[model samples]
Target: MILEVLQLVPHPDTPAKAVPSVLCSLSWQDAGHWVAGFIVGAPSEALALPTPTRPARTDGLWQRTCFELFLRDPESGAYLEFNFSPSGEWAAYRFDGYRAGMRPLELADPWITSTDRDQFNAGMGAHLAALGLDPASIGTLLSTPMPEIPGAPAAPAQYVLNAHLEDPALGAAKTWQLGISAVIEEADGTKSYWALAHPEGKPDFHADACFALEMAMSR
Candidate 1:
């Protein structure tokens, strides 16, 4: 699995201090496994990171330096939000549509580890049942071709790397639009929002425009 290195840009209104940049890499593994790595190009002492603690599900992580992932199913408009903190804490939430009907998504806790305050790694696995997806249907969709739209340019066939299609029984093979973002807090309490893409005005990670990375297994 090739990890795609992506550069996250800070919102224009909220410029970063001390933190030079944030690089994120994501790769999918077989059998519902995926890993994300983040490298913060900044002095470890310049950022205000939460103190180390026993890994557990915690709320309000984004208030500090936190890494976030937003996954959306294009067809259904349902999405999952995962938050990983440098302190080995994590949170997961499910939304019905565009932030409606939110609830805690209880699953096996993600394994999060960080190197000082400059680098972090998060790994997790979720079954199709947990995501409310039908494995057989997704398998069929993967085998079928998409209907072309009128006047639209032809699109090349694309699939998520390491989608595990060889074994449809795995049940967690499907397409997803991912939005990666982070909230960086400086030692002096300055906060900046970073993301692959930002909406027009304020730094809104929940906006649809932020979900720009397309990893289609069967779009």
Candidate 2:
């Protein structure tokens, strides 16, 4: 499993008036599951969060305060986007390249939970397979070999397994550039855009430059 602890910075022109910080954690398990957790460093009453409701796939969650995840294939430039609301609503979209050819990414419902108006969590099942990857191929990729390094000690078996997870020859199923972002709205209606990185000009969560985090996946 690969785990990342990350922080989101507000876009230079759009600063949070009430939210002090946004810290996030992402974990990718070998079983093809993903869990994302976020801590909004402010009282729930201070933000204009969505009303709680039954968990379901919904659109336009980004219009207000919402957490998001972006996964891109570096080689083909294809990507997927997910929006998670504190109210248990969510959305998923796939792009052909960059932000082109968008369509819903169908999958089983993800489990979501929130607490204390400060913490939010979303858990998703085998999304790699849902993204059109063959289950058998993923198992093979996990065992792929790594090239030898001259004058360097041999890597452990597990290290080799992780290193080759990004082999492009195997296709987009194995590697990804990740982006974590959020649209935060204060109770009084002030809004801020937070992301790992932002492009100059406007707050475009779909910007390629914002997908700053990288991941190499195994089985």
Candidate 3:
């Protein structure tokens, strides 16, 4: 159940005059019965300007920037909030699970690297450690690079994931992964969370299109 970001069409009402320099690419796999997706971006050109301005009130800019994970229940949805630091070298995502009692999942240290499983595991351990999670207890890792989507630019960074987190409470371990992207921003802690939008059409899995749309808004 992997959802890939195949294409991104600008809103018809979007002024043709303002085109974005970057687009998003998304891919995912099934974790248990639920689907999990990773998103990355390909920059058409170097981001020369500051953050783009928010799109028209009609455009669903919020849905694009924020990662929404829909569960079996049609009414249930989990959101991973994204924020770009003021310096623009890092981006952070905070995953708020469906259940209100569950603590939010936060990933702040994001980087690109060769498809090295050991290195990726180490990085994931460090990332979790930063969040006060014990890495030693989280066990049994399997990872792979996301498949390339049609029309997406050559990926500047590769994404890899480690599934099966060991948790005694669930009788079975939970599945999760690490998604990396090209845009780099320093985590300054100023931006709280990315807003969610409900554009006219269905939202795609890719974050790049949403980020690009958000960037365009700043311009």
TM-scores of all models?
Answer: 0.73, 0.74, 0.29
> What clash pairs does model 1 have?
none
What candidate 1 gets wrong by more than 4 Å, as runs, is: 117-171, 217-219
lDDT of the candidates, in the order given: 0.71, 0.71, 0.30
* TM-score result, candidate 1: 0.73
Number of backbone-clashing residue pairs for each candidate, in the order shown: 0, 0, 21
Kindly report which residue stretches of model 3 are placed more than 4 angstroms away from their true locations once superposed: 1-3, 16-23, 29-73, 83-104, 112-219
Candidate 3 TM-score, true structure as reference:
0.29
Question: Compared to the true structure, candidate 2 yields what TM-score?
Answer: 0.74
lDDT of 3: 0.30
Q: What does candidate 1 score in Cα RMSD to the true structure?
A: 14.6
Residue-level error in angstroms, candidate 2, position 19: 1.0
Model 3: ten consecutive residues of lowest lDDT: 210-219
**lDDT per residue as tens, model 1, 1-219:** 545889999999999878878878787655356677777777557788887666678999999989998888888988888888877677888888987989998667666655542122111112343356554545554445568789998532211111111222222557788899999888899999999999999999989989989884431
For residues 1-219, could you state the per-residue lDDT of candidate 2 as single tens digits? 677879999998988887888877777654247778777778777888777666678998899888888888888888888888877677878899867999998655665666522122111113344456554555554445556789998532210000011112222237788899989888999999999999999999989879998888766
